[model samples]
Target: MSNAPITEIDIAAFTADPYPDLARMRAAAPITYVPQLGATLLTRRDDIHVQEKRTDVFSSEQPDGLMTLLMGENMMRKDGVAHLAERRILFPAVSPRTVQEHWKPVFETAANRVLDRLAPRGGCDLVTDYAMPVSAEALKAITGLVRMTPAEMDGASQAMIDGCANYAGNADVTRRCHAATALIDHHIDLMLSDPPPRSALAVQMQGGLAMTSIRANIKLVISGGQNEPRDAIAGTIWALLSHPEQLELIRQGMASYADAFAEYARWVSPIGMSPRRVARRDTVGGVTFEPGDRVFLMFGSAGRDEAHFQAADRFDIRRDTQAAISFGAGPHFCAGAAASRCLIAEIALPLAFRRLKNLRLAGDAPFSGWAFRGPTSVPVAWSL
Candidate 1:
C-alpha cells in the first residue's frame, strides 16, 4: 500500500546490478515516488513509454539543480531543432544501410584482430582487450577521426568513466571532468585543424558544421561509445555464463544469434536510467511536480516489469522483445544505437564464443558504480 520506493536501496548497487530492486519497484506501485530523490520513479513499461514519448510534456532537459553538478550537459539535454541538428550529423553511422555496410566490417576487423592477439594465449580482460576496442574502432572509423589511437580514445573515455563511477560532487570529480573534456576537446580540435580526405570526421567538418558543435557531438559519441560497450559486453558475457543453455542455443543458431546482441542489450539495459525535465505543470502517481521537475527514467526497472514481459527478470536471449526502450524512445533516443549493437554482433559476442570456452562468473560479481549498471569487472576463464 505504500507508494514509496525503497530509497535506502543502494542505487549504486542497483546501477551495479538492479534486477533485484527492479522486482520490488514493479510490484509496489509500478509508478512509485522516491521521497529521498524528490522525483517519482516510473517502472512499468507503459508508463515509461508514455512518459518518454511525450517529449513536449516531459522535456529532454533534466531539472538541472543537482545533476548539472555531476554529469555535464551535451546532446542528452537538447530538444527540438538543437537535438535534430546534432542527431543528423551523427545519425549516418547508425543508419540502416551504413550499419549494414560499414559497422559489420569494423566489428569483424576489430574482433578478429584482438582475438588473434589474445586467443592463442588463452584469456585476456575482455573489457579492455575485445569489448572496448571493437566499439572504439568502429566509432573512430565511422567518425573519420584523424588521430587514430586507442590510448587517446581510451584516455578520454576512461576519464569520464572514472569521473562517473566516482562522482561525489567533489574536487576530484571536477578535476577528472575538466581533464576528460579538455583531452577530447583538444583532440577534436587537432583533427579539425588538419582535415583529411575520406575520413568520417573530416567529412563532417567539411559539411559546414562548426568545430564547437563537432567538439560537443564527437565528445558525446566517443564517451557514450566507450561507456556502453564495457558494461554491455560484460553483461552479454555475464548473461551467457548465467544461462549456459542460452549460450549454447546461441552457438548452434549463429545466424539468428546475430540479433541476439540486441536482446542482450534489452535484457542488460546497460545505461541504467536517463534524466528528464517535467515540461509544464503536471502530476504523477498523485504527486504534483511543477513545470520543471527532474525525473530519472528507470529503464532498468521497466525492463523487468512483469506486466510488460513474461518472466521479466530472466535474461533470455531468445525473448520475444519488440524494441525495448533500452536505447530509449521518442526523438532523443540514442543516435548510435545501431552502431552500438553492430559492435556487439560483429565483434564482442563472436570473439567471446570463439575464444572463451565455458565462461563463468569469476568469484563474487563486482558491481559497477554510478549511473550505469553491470559488473565493474567480470572475470571468466577457459582452457587454452
Candidate 2:
C-alpha cells in the first residue's frame, strides 16, 4: 500500500471522458487508492465484482448530494433482507413483459409522432429530436404525468438530469435537488389528480400509505421514470449511430435487435459506478479490508475487463453480455431495468431506424462521466 501511487481520480475528467484514465488504471492497478475522492478505486471485473458484493464494508451512501435526491432511499443505497420487501412492491413497476406491454402503445405513439415530423426532412438530431421525446413521453406516461406540456416535461427532466448527473458541490447540489424534487412533486400531483381508476399510485395513495413510504415510492418511480429514459435514449442513439452496419443488419431482419440493444447497454455501460457496503466482514481478491472502507466498484471499467469479455475494446452489439453490470448487481440491482429495456425497444429502436436511415457518425461525439456514460451531443446526418 505504501508503494502504491496515490492516483487522483478526477470526477471532472470522468465527467468529460474517462476511457483513457480508466484503461490506464485498469492496466496498472485494477485496485488502487485515489486521493481526489479519498477512496480506493476498483476497476477490474474481479475487483469490482467483489466490492459491489460487500454491502456492509463499502456502503451505498450516495456521496453526491444531487444523486441522493434522485435516489433518496432508492434501492441500491439500502441493504440486507429488509430492502427485499420494498423491492417486492417495485417489482410490478419494472417487470420486463409488463413494462413492454405497459408502454408499447405509448412508445409507438411517441416514436411515430417524432418520426413523422423528422422523416420528411430526411435527417435530424437523434438526441434532441428523436431520442429525447420518446423517452420523455414514456417516462411521463409511467409517472402518470399525462398531457404535460412538452416544455414543462423537458424543463423538469433536464433539471432532474442536471441535479443527478451534474455536481457543482454541496450548496449547488442542494438547490438543484429541490428543483428536481419540485419537478417530481409536480408529477406526483398529476398522478393524484387523475388517480387512473386503479393505477399504481392510486392504490398506494388509497392505502393511505405513510408519508415516508409515499414519498419514497413516489421518488423511486418518478425519478427512474425520468432519468433512466434519458440515458437509455441518448445511449441507444449513440450506439445505433456508432454501429450503422449493425443497425442496417437489424433493419434487414438479419439480426435480433433486442439482444443487440441489451449488449449495447452493456457496452455503453451507463450509471457510472455505484458502491455497496458490506453488512458482514469480508475478504476479496486476497486483499483484506476492514468494514466501513468505501471501495469504488467501477462498472464502467468492469464491462470492458478482459476477464469478463473478449476483445473488450470493441463496441460490437452482438456480444453475449450476460446480466451486465450496466444495470448493476446482486440484491441492489436496478428495479427499473426492465422498463429501461422496454423503453429502448419501443421508443429508441423505432425512432432510430424509422426516421433516420443512412445514420453515419459525424465526429468524436461529445460526452462526459465515466459512471454515467452517454453522448452529450452525438451529431449525425441522416436520410430516409
lDDT of each: 0.66, 0.64
TM per model? Answer: 0.87, 0.85
**Model 1: which ten-residue window has the lowest total lDDT?**
62-71
Best by lDDT: 1
Best by TM-score: 1
lDDT of 1 by residue, 77-133 (tens): 678887787667656556767777756776687777877776676555656666667
* lDDT of candidate model 2 versus the reference: 0.64
Stretches > 4 Å off in candidate 2: 1-5, 61-71, 147-170, 197-200, 206-209, 277-282, 286-291, 360-364
Give the runs in model 1 whose Cα sits over 4 Å from its true position: 1-8, 11-16, 35-38, 62-73, 146-148, 161-168, 194-200, 355-364
lDDT of 2 by residue, 162-250 (tens): 55544344566557667766766666775675665323465556655554565556565655555456666766667766767777777
lDDT of 1: 0.66
